[model samples]
Target: MKNTIAERIQDFLKQFPPFSMLSKEELLKVAGQIRVLYLEKGAYVFEQDEKCHDEFYIVREGAVGLYRNSENSQNLVDICDAGDLFGLRIMIIKKNYRMAALASQESIVYAIPSSVFKPFIDENKEVNTFLLETFATHARNYYTETEKGKRIDNTISIDTAKDLSTLRTISYRKKPLTCTADAIVKDIAMEMNARKADAIIVVDEQKFPIGILTDSDLRAKVATGLFSATAVVTEVMTAPVKTYAKKITVAEAQIALIKNNISHLCITKDGTRNSKTVGVFSNHDLLVSFGNNPSILIKEIKRVKKIQRLRYIRKQVERLLTTYLEQDIPTMHILNLISEINDALVIRTIELSLEEMPSQPTVAFNFLVLGSQGRREQLLMTDQDNAIVFEDVEEAMYDETQTYFLELARIVTKNLHAIGFEYCPAEMMASNPRWCMSLSKWEEQFRTWMTTPSEESTLLSSIFFDFQSVYGDADMSNQLSDVVFDGVNKSKRFLGLLGVSALQKPSPLGFFKQFLVEQNGEHKDTFDIKTRAMMVLIDGARILALYHNLKGINNTLLRYEKLASLEPNNKELFESCAKAFRVLLKFRARQGILHKDSGRFIQLNTLSKNDKLKLKRCFKPIRDIQEVLRIRFQLKTFM
Candidate 1:
């Protein structure tokens, strides 16, 4: 009397959407009517233009690729993986199949009879909405204008950045050739010939894009006999597909292609591989849309083989920065975009250095950027702060390993210097043996710094604690973060010491509420905004974040935002800190650009009355946050 197979199928169905909306009793009843089918790679679940089946399918295992036949070839529309629903089109339209569904791998599927599932659509509102949305997304505009539930947007907006057409939405090839991972190279090549297409995307069974095969791959692999035509496309395909969202701008697409040195990009619904592939963007697309502009400057930065050309590109970026400021773009937006550009420069520099090395690296490692650049808040070129953390190795190989990475770092830092970033005066660079070490050694260093609680260690912690992994293995960096939080948990004295350090910077304003100006050096009459104001806020956010054990939040503004969420009573004060930090950072960036130097000092006389007032208003949050740190850490006793 027990239907064991139906119960198993029911259990699997309940884990996914639509079915998840069904009651236990209802799901079991539906499951009893379901039929199970087994399929091998290349087996067809259904073929294009075939009459509708009596049931819809859900992949219980492996992947099912939905391919639309076009121009004598098949183009993959979407992939359905485990728990992913397919064959739903028949349920809605009661029409013939518009695409073929084939198993991309050995698979098991559950066929849920539409006769049983259709009642749920009418009875359960959640199931109806979910299925409709899923159907709409996968339809890829297959529905005509007269279709039910169709709505049009009449809203229009003025174009401010019309000249910057790269900001405009990209138009890509919607019908590029795509095939399953198990598809044959020879057969796909024949299909390409039939369609006169140059590229084919290789997708996984679950419909996520996994790799790409192009004419170049065929010439190098099949023509040269590196691989036989009968071989699966995965053998020669360029893998781990680069995916972008449908909303990706032309400029972003161009840079993404150039930066990764790839020719094609998969445009997905959500800009990640987890979503279905919607279209493909290629170099051919860029050729028409491309113009000589900021994006071109960035593209040149990535393409230039020589380090000297990078310096020229860096100058162009400065001009771009000026133009952005003049355009009055949001400061945070500018910060993020320019920071990405800066990161590109650094990442390219590392790539070039690796190529110049006599031999390849032996073990996994991570390149870390520290201080402002690490926080992704460096809008203006400042001193380079970086380090290296390689995977732990045997004691015997330590010296040689360190020497190799240090040499690599030496070249990278030298290249970065040539590209406008100055070297750290204190030598806090990966080239320094003290900063470049194995992961375990780095962990030990943090543990020692926290347990000892010295002034020097606290200074180093502040600098190094904010590190962001720029290249290589990110897991190494994550492990380092784990060590940092672990060390913080074990040492309360270090926490108090860090708190005292945050409070060490005096109030940005004097007792008379006047701007605190430097009394000595070249900036004698100018306010030391860097130390007097920004540092107070930065240190306060950093210390508070560590006290609450907030990991991975390094940017001062973001730190305040996260802290506000954690303590609602202090939310107002914390949000003010984030707002003030943003204002100060923008002010510093603007001054830096004007002077063509590090924006640390600001002359009080150059500002308008309102500018001066804005600066004073931003400082109140600094005083308040520092006081919060003092009381939270009982810093009065430590002081």
Candidate 2:
């Protein structure tokens, strides 16, 4: 069944994203599944909100204009030239098209079946990134300012029959960490951690694969502060693990992850649960096949010398983030991992900057990461919020010390800007002279803010309070935390003000049992996820942590968990907050990733009913916690 026409199509695809990311063999496999269609000039490909087609289109000849029909006006927001991909929204998010695709001229396009492409996205992240970026670009272009929903869908889970299949087989890891079926889930999870493995297979006495437990499972159960880790392995494991022959085609492994809604598959000697385990196939293994690995990324980051190269690595991290999200890794873990990567990039940038300096630093200095970066909650590219803290010296040396670090901060911020972190619009960055100062000055500034809490002070508290040292003196960070804790303890009014700030955003739900969406301005008629849902959770967590004199826990979800432990009387409420925060973080991340934006806001109309319900379920705690804060802090005056 060799098709010469498909071969030509593959030749064209090899020059594009996702296709260029794939090997020659994999490219042809995708090409074979593509159904070539010719469109006369000005022909329609898909209409707005029509039930999604099973295939996504890529233009081969001519052009396509993705247009939205609103208020009886069809506005062409984006045009697709040859090789541009269109009509992928249906595949992602499993929703209908938000925009209609029309041939701008006579065109020939390759309709790649979603079935064939979905597996690739799960296995090859570059392909996944390509699809997501495409959807995000379209969403940002059209959906951001509009009430239009159904703009995009998730790229994974598309099912199309394979026609041009590659002979590629996914090689599973041999001797995967396994435990007896009766083993305690806590013990099993411990074994997994000890082995540095994210998954563990449960086997029968006969050494047959009976169940598989993955990181995602551990996250859904253990991380929520729900199930006891002491539960039996069977309690959390996906029972009757999908077993395949020791040698499984890449296509088969992918289909299994999708069909079973599972991340790990057991490869057994006889391709059945009755047989012995031979290896384990996981999404991580698939991603590694495409040359994406954290260890490798670290290596690349270290060796990269150019600012542009660091930018490139940061881009790779985006693709990596998409992979982790697709695998349903806990958002907290994803945040931590990506934060480490960001820290590394910043550290490397510092090294490069210092290497370029005329002389080494005369005294000790530390780099401070403020805001979301400071809290390790940052998952998307954001404005740089950082400062420089240098050692105190003699008055003569103070100016010299300031000059040296100022020059250093300028270089670091410049390099970081080049690396894709935009300059702080408010000039909160370290390069600003007011923020770049000796450690003693930072203490003075923090003390002033805490003692004299105001609207501006409260604003600064949200950013500066979460300072974590990315590089330099760890003891300085400890000292900073001590200052913050001492100030909050001494100023009870400050804590009350903080509590009021936490409750600033009212309950997410309105009187009509509908989401209280934004009514006007830039994000009109949309759900302000950050200002409404997530910030309420974050603010509540922050103020509670302040009240408890808790230090070192900055992430909102983790803070709630800490609150739960500290206030066992309200454990149920705190746990609900933690879970709600987790869901909101994931929701924002998906919206952000799909739109290539901050993911802080979302259009209500764009979400599915199930998604809406999931969101609504999280709001009860907002009301409950605000009540607790209101009574505890006597916030009637603030309200």
Candidate 3:
């Protein structure tokens, strides 16, 4: 009489997407045919290249690992935890499974046959749309346009299911002021003044955007006397305007403006210049959306002649970080946005420093950020680790050039300190004469470090090897990277030394699975998460990436993702390491924000049971990844 099991299935299914969009009756009908299956860890629900099972499955408990096999190895594409849906590909195509689904942990899963789900796809638009978005997100570049269209009609929509506030649809200026291409520049300028508008779109007879004219256009062309005020707008207007659909998200709009190097974007009906124009999205529009708008802060950083103003902006950045963390925004998104803002601060500081110089140096040089900041992973207001590398000058002029850059580095680092980044206690900064050098000297520095590894050189290499150019000539950074990789590629002894450095940090957990807190010093009875947990992952990632010669990838999370792709045999471990790193990073940031410090050391007693469990969960991967490094580098003898 009572189908309690089916009813329970509906409860779980309705909590997730696609099924969440389905009506009660529809979900019930689908749940009625669902078959509940239990899987032991390492058991596969579906195998790659096998014929579709006429069913799609969802994780009801534990986790499922989706793997794509290639080159005799299975790569983890994605891990689906509780309430996560997988196996949707069967509903979209009549082909074999492109990926295999296996239980990553002992799990319970619900399988709903396509026969019961196909009718709902045809009948419900929301369900269809949700599935379409899910498919696009998880697509591995294999699905054809026709195959994708089989599940839903072609229509682009912003994925609001994501957590980032920037992903929300933008509130752009509707009913934009428009003008014809033939309108006189004087008339357009006068009209813009009367309307108090900074910009106007140039539209064709059919209202399709052709170009745009802004105050900048008038200032550069009319005020500069390049064109007469009475000249036609076409003579001065910026042609080939960038257009996006009305549903463009703030993130998309921001990217369009930045990438195009424009102040405004025209919103069109069909997302093309040929389509009917609807509204305008200006740089100002972004300012009103988020209180701590990154673009606006960046603009302010660049515009502020005084360095003290940057300190205020940096404070706002911390507030933004707090908001993102409180709102549970994706950690990777937070990391990237903060990195960009931090970089803007450093770049602006460098720009202002150059202005204070007696005269511009003649040779090309690069301003590099070392350590965490260099990897684009710095979150909180941390210590500054930077260096300077200038073009090699004739031996006679070398001293003069080095002195100029050293002075420049001193100013930049000092200003950066004012903006909240503390000076590195080890004095590992650009201002250090040993760090500010010519390109050839820097190359030699890396060669020496790689050719002959020691405690001091290894420690310095750990910081300097992650150096990234935040300002100045990027070619210099690339050249240094080439030398480092060249030296590392040939040095087995150095790899072993680095591997030893990674294993130096003991396991975070003890024999009883209890956290190993600090034993003495000022941090007594506290946990040094940075050194024990985060660095273990960071070091493992860096060493593996270096061993694999993965150039230009410095961010810890990205390094792990790239490693997973490159070494599919160890994909699960790398993916776990990446996930663990994200969790640990976010945890540290939250702690730092709460205590108003770097969040490096944690008082274990302060943590709630759940918080402690989450921290412990992240440490397992740290231990597992360390073992991989030990075996891979043959560190037994060295240790």
Candidate 4:
């Protein structure tokens, strides 16, 4: 009864439902009465039509397969892995087991008493909904129509007989009316009316779309006397119209609309404004083409009320990103759009965690996204790096306040992992006690790092300096940034140390002009594009920008642009760096799409002759930029 194995089982069960919804005492009670069942590969826990056991099971280790018995064969319904719950349908409905539960591999499962968990199913709405949904998905896949009606009367699952992929690709109207920028507003309105359209594209003399004249533009700019009816279309049109290339998927088109808060996307022969206009994609068209819209995704995220539903949405976003890349959408635009959705997921996870807390937070707090995510450049699913900054509290309440935030951060980060963002391998997440801190303590920590520049301090500074507020009080994050920049402004030595740190990777090219590759570990024999190439540019940009007290600029390309403006003498060098960085990013994005990994590793054998040459071309600017960093910071002495 007092075995460590029982305590381990309790710990595992305490995270999942209906066990999670139970009080600690009630959970331990069930835990005490639990039996540990170990089964080898291909062993069945219970066969179809067998009487229900007195308890349901949670997979503690390995895998379990839930299979349905047909007239002639058994069909696999679902695979249950670690942290997944199974065998609960019988306990919930009080019926004979309709499906056989078998261990797909050597497995350990916790058998929790049905009597102890039953009360929680009635009490926790979220737990109940989760169980019902899981049962519905399994039943829809396995059960016959007759069994569905009788076995799960209250369950709701869409069992439509249509290919979901086909539903997502249905085409819509694209031939929209167009007018020259110099055309009169009244003529544009007439063109819209004549074509039976709600909007008219305003193009330059080259036939490239430059602006749009929609019904709202007409009412606000023309009908309101803000502009004359005889005014040129450019006077009333929305300039720099959102544009997309031909062959965009319904998901990309919808995401564009939501991100820009626009109803239409100007389709061009090429994606930029320099190309001829081809067609138009409207929000209405996207809705008709794909039944699901951005609002539906947001609604789903909110309605999730559980981590599993959020995981499903995250998978859908991955599918969306894959489609976007296949269609050759701009990487910057894709990064911005996907990062927004990722931020929203983190925000929602925080909201859900708050609900799970026993009470509201004792004080206001801000959630900070660090490293690549903070810079809004995370394209692939990477480890999450984050920290929490809470408002200062009295000395008496400091320890308890910190404890509360740590607990909240744990829940938030765990849920983030469930949604596809891997846990930070270095433990840089908010869940780490060293990171979850009060504002004053964080300020002191930053000051310590800035004033004393050790190898570890410089490394931590490089990561923490890029912090962005993903959720909570923006003022807290702004204050922390102010503290960081103020410290850097005073410590010239520290800035030089940062510059030296940024130069550690050297050039990404080898002596024979071959691409430099990783030396060891899991990624041995691979080229670490992120550490060797991308981070060199990113770290250099951050250090130089901070030295100049630059603000509101994070992207490496944009930082170079700002630096060019500040240092006219080095304008060409900076501009070249900007262009090379963009080219390298595009290359990495394309490779990531092809390999479905982080794009950090490159297979030299897979590269075409042209790609290898193009990659080599970018290395020149990388070497030149490192030289410039060395001179400007006088890093020769440190090296």
Candidate 5:
């Protein structure tokens, strides 16, 4: 007869421990021979002098007290929580029980037959390591002077940035209150007053954070009579609010607050501005994260007057970035703050360059940042990809205007290199005469690329299309965006070609469910995360955003998020892509910081079981989105 109780026992065991390492067939066999025992509070499961039992026990519910006895006195050693295992020492050593087990509360435990479990212990490395760590932490710790593992303690903290690798996790105010962007200031202020909260994040219909309103806004903008109290939140709230994903520690949270100069930060589901709000942090949370002095760095950046000063400052920023990564700050948050610092460096370099010039420019021009700078997802110093888009000039004066702008671009790019940004190998910077052009010329170039997409055109446009105006006339950049999107809107054939470009990288996994790694050359057997993983999401987001006509939103995570809101039926899939993009970004940044290089090619053998699982989980979303793109654009027919 089939044993339903044992099948249920196997199900519970599979989610936990060394049992999880066993095959379903093997686990069921072990489960079939196990015995279930129920005990009320203070009931003894085993005594100190009991003979060895063939089975070891796993607590399914409540808690068990493991006590050490000496001279007619019992010392409570440890409280074993749910999923904790005990009575394994006797089975391994073939000795009598050394300690007594009693129910601290009513509990259910499964006694596993050791005869059926020994083979699995010898076979699985992860299982063996886990069991050894468990014993060393639980059994051996109770015998140590400090007795660290005798209780579940999470109050550890490391203060200095130098020692940040061991910092503790900081808690946040979870499930924070939020209002939509459409809400009026007066109503939201009343809600804030009622809740006694200092700030309220303004979200969109999907609860995606768009901006934030605070008591400061009420005082500075409303109380001063600058804006009416009945004005909408969008009219006053600070837009592009700083956001973070759920897993942050004391060190990461502090850096975020000081770096952004914000008293409060919006914690969201994906740590991008496009995700639903989940929690919030303020100056108080910074204190909780063990506040470090960050004013020095900010003062330097703001007061910087030379290229060498910024070069020195860039090193400090790298150190700060290392600490944040080591402390496990969410990648999205790090990207947001670090990118701000990078942009400031560019803007400052541009200012200093203009000061060195003989006079102000003859016409308004914008420094168009491209490549990773354009995406705003850059984590490390990479090649500069930029161009110059100046106001249109009379054809007769074109030669003069081009010469003036080229000279200006030369100084700006040179200063940027001194400030640590590497020069583009392909001369893609504004310093290249080809990249510096009139606004109308840039518009014509974009129209040409979209209407006639080829391999070379696709490669060049992929970097150029994500152009962001770092400094100068912001309005000029807006005009360029409208022109590019307008051209894309006119051609279904172009959209299909862009869709085909997105599918250029196939699945990141191969047969045997292993990462599809570089087969030969310098990075043989190593994973190409940038080309195979990050690019997939980045390309997908760009094409989708263009299709939906979303402009000025360059970050891939925000792109997927905006896509999710626009298509509710595909929201889950889109959100999954966003989450996966974040995980990959974080993973790459961490690897980069660890190995002191571009974290592009990753060695697979270095990863643990858990790390592999996290990386593998991201591939599913990548596969799903590519299929959606293929079917939607009918790209297979073109292929």
Candidate 6:
């Protein structure tokens, strides 16, 4: 037989998982021996309680449903789609199959003998780690009996910045078991023991830290007769406790601890010894905060004097995101926390760009983040779509002012690229001359798009209309928004144009509930989840929210919630649309985290039957919403 089959197997295998970690020769070897099995729809590959097979299967076509058989019922546990591997839990655990695999449709599966895959697993560290993590996450879900996949280990990376603004900064003992200057050494020791503290802070009546007495102080001073047991605490205590600000970073705390040769650093409001004591940072506290913390990273970004340092910090944020997703933290919290860090990075980029300018900005300016960043839902590093709005300048100065902001935008966008946000392919970013403009120019631009409402103008409006102030003057953004709403109010044609744009893509599923997977390009046969499912919800929400004159809220989910309140008759549909948006977003984030890309493409065969059913459920509202848009806006007349 030709090696075409084996090569095809390798091509599919190289795209996923532990198999991707395998070398070409090794992968080919496994592929060559792969036993191709064909099964009719509803045919069983293995049953629960049956002894394990020597090989595990990867779907070549169609789908397989994995069902867990309990005493009374068989529950669908997972669905394996094309390119998804299954029947391996038995191989991993050396036990009988606890779940039964049945062909969900007429399917082709390539069974690679476990013996062939085992050698690679043993030799490749990444392969081993992937298997361990995947198995652990799956096992955690099973044991918890919850859909939440795995509890992420928080200490692994630094980006775990949950909404720090919301989290109460942990309070610590500020006075710190202090004793007066006249207190006896024995009294200090007793006080330390009473408080169960390793050390005690010595202070004057004003509650300011003066010195510290530790277990070592008693051991070296009183125990060795360097001081009598009856001596005053001042005679034994080490003078001047190290101090820091309440906003001290974990790294700064580490450096302070190392530099001072001290265990605790007194925390004050102003970060100096002169301020009133707010709290204390012990070595233990330093260790605790050193783990994944978004606040620490944000603090680091503010201190970074160079673009390269900011770039390094951004990478740490990405690593943190990977860990966060792996842990399955609440998706909303993850989104909020990451958005803050991203905002901080953008702000830092702007600050750095200003420092490099020939002179300060000619006028007040505001940087506007459009699209996903505006929505505060960007998880992965996507394109940077932004604009600039400088203060209204005299007609004579307008061109120069626009040039100045455009130059600034170029620098900021460049730094953003250095830190991993891909440059927008369509040149939609602030660096683009078309997007960078003075306040009046931007207002005019928005007015034209809103009034004319051509295909290009509608597309531009779809993206730019969601602009949120990222940095600089807020009034400029306010004026722009006012102009947009005014123009939108005057033009039914514009709203209709937007409605047609939202309905550009058809529903993601066919009548039989099969995914309309891509038919061409590098991602052929893989479903483009973003264009097919996610964009539908995002575009629909934007159109409806703008049509309703909803302002401030750009998030698709929140927009839909607002829409629900505005139109009570359609509340259920709007609510379902919101829920569907969240579900699709979570799915895309999980899939993106899994594959390390945009999570746009999904292998339909890889989804479990339940997941497919859940995804299909989202389309009902999508179809209904499109119909509403068509009827209300009379979009068909425009078509």
Off-target runs (Cα >4 Å) in candidate 5 are 1-296
lDDT agreement with native, every candidate: 0.80, 0.78, 0.82, 0.76, 0.78, 0.77
lDDT of 2 by residue, 283-315 (tens): 655433333345545655777666655875676
Per-residue alpha-carbon lDDT of candidate 5 for residues 331-361, written as tens digits (9 for 90 to 100): 6667776787788888888989999889789
lDDT digits (tens) for residues 1-639 of candidate 1: 998887888898887778878999999999999988999999999999999898999999888888888888886555666667888876665668878999878899999899999999998987875675455334432221222423221111112112334446788888568899889988999999998777898876666788899777788789998899899988989878899988887656665665576778898778888877788887655644442234445555677687865764675566566656655666666766677678889889999999999999999999999998888888888999999999898999999999999999999999898777999999999999999999999999988898877889999998999999989999999998998888888877788898888888856788899987888887788888888989888888888888889888888878888999999999999999889988898888788865557888888898999999999999888889878888877888998
Candidates sorted by lDDT, descending order? 3, 1, 5, 2, 6, 4
Which portions of model 4 miss their true places by more than 4 Å? 1-299
Best by TM-score: 6
Per-residue accuracy of model 6 over 229-265 as CA lDDT, tens digit each: 9998888888777777776544445445644656677
Better by TM-score, candidate 6 or 1: 6
- Across 1-639, the per-residue lDDT of candidate 3 in tens digits comes to 968888989998876667877889888988999999999999999999999788988889888888888888887656676666788776666667878998878999998898999988888876675565455334423222323323221111112212224446788888999999889999998899999788999999999999999888888889999999999998899989989998887655655664566878999999999889999988666544443346656655777776756775686677667657755777778877888889999988998989998999899999999899888889999998999999998999999889999999899989998778999999999899999999999998899988877899998888889989988899999999999889888887897898899899866889999988889898898899999899889889899889999999999999999999999999999999999999998999989876668999998888999999999889879889889989988999997
lDDT score at residue 364, model 3, on the 0-100 scale: 93
10 residues in a row with least lDDT, candidate 3: 153-162
Could you tell which candidate, 3 or 5, scores higher by lDDT? 3
Model 1 C-alpha lDDT versus the unseen true structure:
0.80
**Runs with alpha carbons beyond 4 Å of true place in candidate 3:** 1-292
| Candidate 4 vs candidate 5, lDDT winner | 5
Give me the overall lDDT of model 4.
Answer: 0.76
Candidate 6: minimum summed lDDT over ten consecutive residues — where?
A: 138-147
Q: List the residue pairs that clash in candidate 4.
A: none
Which regions in candidate 2 have their CA more than 4 angstroms from the true location? 1-292, 637-639
Model 4, span 328-356: residue lDDT tens: 66666666666776777888999998988
